[model samples]
Target: MQLFPKTTTFTLFCAFLTLIHAYDVVREYSGVSFFDEWDFFGSWDNLTLGDVYWLDKSDAFSQGLAYVNSVGNAIIKVDNMHSVQSPQKRNSVRITTKDSYAVGSLWIFDLVHIPYGCSVWPAVWSLGGSTWPEGGEIDIMEAINLMPSNQMALHTTSGCFHNYTPPNQLGATLVTDCSTAAGCTVGELQPNSYGSGFAAMGGGVFATQFDVAGIFTWFWSRPNIPSSVTQSNSTSGIDISQWGPPSASYLAAGQCNITEFFTPQQLILDITLCGNWAGLPEVYFPSCGNRGPTGICYNDNVVGDGSNYNDAYFEIPYVRAYTTGGVAPTPTATPFEIVSKVDISTYPGYGSVTIPLSAVTATNTKLQPSQMFFPGNGASQRISWLQIGVGWWMTSIGVIILIELL
Candidate 1:
């Protein structure tokens, strides 16, 4: 017969800790649900965009710039009514999430199309405060005019900059100092990475992970998306660890203190016309100069020359946030003691017991998760059983002593 039946039972107990450890989907925004979760910004236009035909905030639905479509997708588009002769302000939409998120979370964006064209500036970025870059801004995706590649940027107060290392998987670093008004940027080199090129390639996925280490962003254009990310639902496991190399990585290990520079930020999606970046005649003409009259493109030409606003929009499939189960803390060090060397030769009878000094010292022990298992259905009951199991082991240790004595 086994000396300790309880000990054997405890050792074989199996625990299914799927819920407590797995990353939970904190929030999901899509279709009509997306409209409900996000708040429409109806205030006067602010980005200093000279060419935009700002729509009335009160008549957003009537203007056809913001609404849920018959297919149940959240539709935010620009008005096609404006033309060069009329030069009427074209209707556009801007919206932000009602909720905010902090560091140590993963954000995923599945887009069907994003804005592109002359004098068109579209962006999906995150911000913390109204006083500009003080609270910091993370420009997840932003571009001006018909740029081929996606641009990712970070804007913050002085002293925050990138600690660049070789082999950046996404794009080349354009600016390292984040405090500049223009912000630090990393530009992607792929032809199909952004704008019309992105649409032609069947859109894609953009994911960002934020933690103590820093922030990392990844892109998977349609067919190339990982199954784990694409197939994940409420119950299915979504392991960020398996997503592979990131396109852009900002490490706070040496230079930036992420927590100090960033704060609880809300997601913003908007498309503006001929604002600060795209307004300059000299800068705007390079990409779209040939298209405009007399080989010239200007801010007013966006509306005056009459470019169709239909293509200047964003079609997002969904946006999701996952609460990361952070790295577990290191276990406490095992108890131990140090003893002075014993002069056994000085002892009379005890001199024969020549035990090595190291042997008597306590062995450092590390308790692995597998060592303790509670075979129960619910968490509360399992916890109760765990306490009982621990008590049983203590009893088993005592019984072992008793057996030795006998």
Candidate 2:
């Protein structure tokens, strides 16, 4: 039975405080990171203990349309022709240091849906909790509107840079031949012929794994295999070790690309309105009155603070942290008092208790989406989660607590 070890009640009951340094509250701060806005204040308000994740979106930009039940595999629908003062202000849910992230941690952001067009910019990036880029920024997903699928990249100083390209620019198309690459326009990367079969199956899955070693690997999956990506890269399949530059599988095999660049980084998620990437010369430039002879995307569909942009949001099923086991290192005592030890003292222990999701709020209001209970020694008796601590949140607590992102 896995009891949190007990000491015989023979000597003095000295009390040591368990380093309860972790506080679970997801919210945005007032400061802005390098590549974006300042007026917007993003946050994770309703958060619970378990895999507490829900979607927060703005219907104003999306025309109030949502992608669910796999219809059209269209999770996002942004208008490239639209222009805005701050791309960062449009539809961005910031995942900041307040969310508990740091070096030696991994963050996995999974997305599946429409990933291209003009002026549409979707990204998963990070900023330093203390400094700006010096704290490090990792961009897991940065797909300029127009490409069929997505692009993986990193942003850091020269001394700390971490970036990767899809095996080929045809990243998502390699899994599904959705790109009409042949009909590609001026700034757009893929042919107009492609939309990746996002409609056929459910949306696809895009994930990033940041390791303690400071390596970041990004990959994607579509409803069907994308021919566009395969045409761009050398390998294609359910297993995409040969796909990204620093493939996680490749690293397992003793090779590296991501680790070579940035060793430690924070993961961020944001959908900007119009900025560097979305406002590229070849991209949303046409709508800005910068047109070529043919005049495609030159109509200027959007003017100021564009309306009716696609509502792109993420439905996170779970976020977990794990470690590949190694030799046992020297054990340090965890300072947690035995308020009431788990009743493992009984072989077939007492039954478990269920905690109300609402009862576990730590100011963020994140409810419990999943449950965790440990039954000891095949014991009949069990215990559900027990509350060890509670309190209002502090700003300093946002740092130091490592968010286990995998």
Candidate 3:
């Protein structure tokens, strides 16, 4: 009278557990099809006030600002051929992913080169809300003016602070408050993590895991990329438990509420010439040397012939997004308008403002597989209890049916 035999029940339970643990490919933006997954930002420079004009899709391809190279890598570069006079911005490209990703996901960026040079500010980051820092912003890979290493940061509303740091993190914590202007930042301690040194090392992989527990970022040079990531494809799902310690770790246990502060994040990639962060005299002069007679970031580095930007381009192999069998909400592509007022007094020496973009619609939509499952070992085992509870419920229902028949 039993509904299922012991062996059958055990096998079913195991299958369910496998589904929960598996990391399936949600999206793969790579090769020639890379441009199809993203939308080019066409408006004028408003947010960062970078001295560069963002190109549309047609213009980007026509002018060769964005294209697929011979080796199948996606090349998104600043204009190195054109000379720009004063009062005109240089030509560059900024792209945002059509799809947005929430928590319980992993993002892997495989690259061959990263933009770097004097007055060249490049970022591979994500923005959640239309309003700045309210939804949240995750700076996965960002630096300016020939920086030696990359900086990972988290920008959120007030009250969120990094109370705990993962023991295995390889980066140095520069800021602890996850505030709007100067978000909690972690600087990579590894050599050749950014700029010319990173390109010379044959580029590498930057993987970010967003879970309920917290956010984690890992960096691997080309030669040292783990087999779990390098060997992973769309078919064979990746297991984060196999990957070792991350380069940067932001734990959300007691401090930040991952679901509240963070939303479905849209991936963004851009090269801005001397905006707020890189344009400041205090920021540019120290790292990039004195500004000479021009005495300004735009005049010193952004003007004249575009030879300085030859190194300012991104040579990416692919960008992959993975989820653990969770159904995320369908995202609407909302166009945001930048606010005209600029506040330069907030960041002190950094010369950056807060809340430059107006608020778009905010949603509290939740995705499944939403537990804190990361670092693979302890966290993975912790999530098994949920599976066990489900298995027990099924067994109990089977016994009740058998008893009723008897």
Candidate 4:
């Protein structure tokens, strides 16, 4: 009786502590949200105090967003004027450093986006601090008009670029694999034949979890996924530690990954059209705020020096995070269900059940029957449609459990 009570008692106490720590941990994960909602400019030092942070754009604030001017190609004096509606919307900053992290443990980024368009180059990505090709860079979502498709990539000296095709296209492609000295790339489409249509349905969330194991995975859902809703959806971890460091990256390792160097990573919401990446040709701007994408658009002598960086940008509703000692619910263990459904109503199966397979795969991981999925009996009247998807199992053994798909 005491053991049960004792454990319950201890668990309750831990629960209380978790409640108190939840906000703090949550703050670490939601660094970008806090930065957006609050005025954290110039108070960089104060931000470090509570893990809540914001950037100081030594200029004016506009449309409840930050706007900075070109100090020249790379450097710019930032302002709080967030202009640009859609077309690669959002601006971003880093939080990790070479010294320490904001939480000193693990972190999860739950990103929500508006939608996509041509002139839009919206994305959620990360750059390593230590050394180029060594520290690492993660491209979460990058889609433009030229390539109106979603892609996730890992950039490191240790690994090549691994990307995901929009949806429906399958088979991983890579001439070589990424290593400390080399890297590789892989891509595929989604299972459903939907062309980013669900994204417009709103509440699309893409999550990335960086861990100690050489594994870092990526996941996406039209809406926020309940912990582990689908095992087949989680991306395979890409090992990048072997690269040593990525000093050549935009942000040095000390500033890129070390929390001590920067606040929780800053969230960017921009939709720039035809700049460096999209191959937008040069324009002869008669003056500031007068430039437009390609072809010749009439230019007029604009008034203010403000609209200097006129480009596309996206819109977001909310951004939150989860870390140790925070106010949010401690992230529960999300169970993943790799659903390999076979419409036996059309084709019977005691053999391999052919489901619509179009997720990303790599060279090391073969796309050929990587594993046979046996749904047993998909249409059992008494069994219902409940036990009809792929179940979980130890990598060494076979799978166990059958979940109903309806």
Give the best candidate by TM-score: 3
For all predicted structures, in order, the TM-scores are: 0.72, 0.41, 0.78, 0.41
Q: Global CA lDDT of candidate 3, please? A: 0.74
**In model 4, how large is the Cα lDDT of residue 384?**
23
RMSD of each: 20.7, 20.9, 10.8, 18.8
Candidate 4 per-residue lDDT over residues 1-406, each given as its tens digit: 2323545555555444433322212232222333333222332212111111123333323323343223211111211144433222223222221112232123333433332332233445443332233344454455433232344444454323233222221213331323322122222133211124434544344444432212233344454343332222222221211212111111222212322222223223323332233322221222112334423211111112224323222333333333322122222233333243212222111111111112111121111111101111343222322322211112111211111110
Q: Which candidate achieves the best lDDT against the true structure?
A: 3
* Per-residue alpha-carbon lDDT of candidate 1 for residues 205-300, written as tens digits (9 for 90 to 100): 887766657777777778778887888864454666446566666777676788899876677787776655665555566666676565544433
Looking at model 2, residue 213 earns an lDDT score of 36
How would you encode candidate 2's per-residue C-alpha lDDT over 215-253 as one tens digit per residue?
434343443233433332112112223233322211211
For candidate 1, give the lDDT: 0.61
Each candidate's lDDT (Cα)? Answer: 0.61, 0.30, 0.74, 0.28
Q: In model 4, which range of ten residues has the least summed lDDT? A: 365-374
Worst 10-residue lDDT window for candidate 2 reads 177-186
Error of 2 at 15 (Å): 38
The collision pairs in model 3 are none
- For model 4 the local lDDT of residue 112 reads 34
